[model samples]
Target: MSLARRSLMEAAAARFGWRRAYGDTTQVDALLTEQTETAYSEAADHAALATAKNTDALHLQPCVLDVRGRVLGDALYLEGLLSGARARGLAPELIERLEHAVDHGHELTVLLADTVRTTTAAHATGH
Candidate 1:
């Protein structure tokens, strides 16, 4: 999940021209992964199936956020942490722990959602 999220962040960064201010030249590869033919095939298949079935499986409802809050495009600030890790040469174990913390934070978001008011983007924006 972290790997996939990092790729999305890279894409967003490229699209928005976010500069890589710091990072080493050395490349780190994941030593552990399933021997799949393609990384995105399963996700693609699920998305296609959901679309063909006209299901809400891939549907997204807008998150009603604070008006004053800034829109950090990446999920749970993982991208920022990843950049920091690279800049400071942090250990992989610490990065993994941080990823776990983000997962926990997402769990909290789900738990806290019921307490907050929510509406569609159209409704929230009076569109």
Candidate 2:
């Protein structure tokens, strides 16, 4: 993983209450890289299979329909955190950027979860 992605993941994890399990930078970097690569591979495999079956549109229909609901939930979650941070009188610019990042993270989380769930279901049903 690139330094930027690793940093972003670390920050997002911290924001979401994921503690650092490894104290050393080397260990943390290795873990993050491994986990990210695994996730990417899983997502790619899911996408390839879905494409091969021409099921991408069908699988994504729910997400497309619920886009607004998902975004609103993510925004409210982020806004609550930002409001708390702001109450502490922290830097406004940093809070704004963090809120944006959190929203992006939420989207990624939802997409990844959907892909994983779809792939798992396909495998279980021998699809």
Candidate 3:
């Protein structure tokens, strides 16, 4: 599920139903997933049989989001968290961005951060 969709569902659950919300969602998700897999299988088979050729296989790629954009986005999210904590007179133990990067380890993090920075720079330079 997408983050936005999950957030909306969570908000709805908080505002409306109290019980079995996730349980209901789980059942629905399972059933829908089963149905979708079956449909895709049938469709793929029919296409291949009709064309008498191998169907083109699509590959899923891993996505690396921009570090700066993600950091700025997290800052915006902290505004929400901090505001909520302040309203309830509580101090939230939020993780700092540097700490998060460090937690991912040195070598892997360098490569990941490089990818984000490279992409952002490329986009900025209109490449």
lDDT of residue 118 for candidate 2: 73
Can you give the TM-score per candidate against the true fold? 0.29, 0.44, 0.25
Worst 10 residues of 1 by lDDT: 62-71
Measured by lDDT, the strongest candidate is: 2
Query: Which window of 10 residues has the lowest lDDT sum in candidate 2?
Result: 56-65
Ranking by TM-score: 2, 1, 3
lDDT of each: 0.53, 0.73, 0.55
lDDT of 2 at 22: 73
* Candidate 3 C-alpha lDDT tens digits along 1-127: 7747866876777788553344587777975786798899899876666456422211101234434445556655555655666677663444344344444444454566676566667666755
RMSD of each: 14.3, 10.1, 11.8
Q: In candidate 3, which residue ranges exceed 4 Å CA deviation?
A: 1-62, 66-75, 91-113, 118-127
Give the winner by TM-score: 1 or 2. Answer: 2
Ranking by lDDT: 2, 3, 1
List candidate 1 segments past 4 Å from native: 1-75, 86-89, 117-127
> Over the stretch 83-126, how does candidate 2's per-residue lDDT look in tens digits?
88888888989698878877786776677567657756775676
Per-candidate total of colliding backbone pairs: 0, 0, 0
Candidate 1 lDDT score relative to the true structure: 0.53
Candidate 3 achieves a global lDDT of 0.55
